[model samples]
Target: MDRRFNKHEKLKSKKLINKLFTEGQTVSAYPLRLVYLPTSLNEANTPVKTGVSVSKRYFKKAVQRIRIKRLMREAYRLNKSTYFNNLTTPHAFMILYIGNKKPTYLQMEQAMNKLFNKFINATHKATSDEKNT
Candidate 1:
């Protein structure tokens, strides 16, 4: 696995971000909530475009928020290949840090793994159901 979150994989479009919040489905694992929307992207080969967000309302300081975002991104970078590489279509994902306190890297990673597993099961189950019908 490449184990890198490169430029093209970063979800930076303002219009897509807005649409995701309105139309996306979520899978939450305590401190982290992943909001994902199935969408077509210009990068046809990348299966997922991802963004990480730390709420200023919870962290209050820019430094704290930045740290959280970094941690979230690191966690996602490490876990992305195992959980996301096999998807058949492109999707946009925004991972939100919903916890109030600062988190250690291990905690962030564990939560990320759980969050991704939940999302995979949800999406795969829905797809299998569609095929069955």
Candidate 2:
């Protein structure tokens, strides 16, 4: 697997970001809130871009914040392909960590996958409802 996620793959549109936070479906798992946008550009060359962050308010120690950010990035990298394959359309996301303590790499990845699946299911349900309406 290519370890690089290019610029286009990253979700960078301000409008999309606003929509994601305001109108997008959100799924939470203790340390993570998976906020996703459902529209995407459908092209094979488009690479997925991702951004990782740790809140300093929750983690005062710089070391702790860095470690959590690293773990989050690794988790996203590993499970990203799964997310890519599962995309119903082009989507944007931010995986915010809400837990107090940092978790192991495996733990983060598992949480990510679980949260993503939930997000996808929610998206599907919403779409179905819209179709019926």
lDDT of 1 by residue, 40-130 (tens): 9998778999999988888898999999899999999989999987888899999999999999999999999999999999999999999
Candidate 2 deviant stretches above 4 angstroms: 1-3, 12-16, 40-44, 47-49
Which stretch of 10 consecutive residues in model 1 shows the poorest summed lDDT? Answer: 1-10
Best by TM-score: 1
What TM-score does candidate 2 get on C-alpha atoms?
0.78
* Residue pairs whose backbone atoms clash in candidate 1: none
Tell how far residue 128 is off in model 2, in angstroms.
Answer: 2.3
lDDT string for model 2 (6-110, tens) is: 566666667777777898667887788877656655555553435566788889999998899888877777777766665555666777888877799888988
Worst 10 residues of 2 by lDDT: 41-50
In model 2, the Cα lDDT at residue 132 comes to 100
Model number with the top lDDT: 1
TM-score of each: 0.96, 0.78
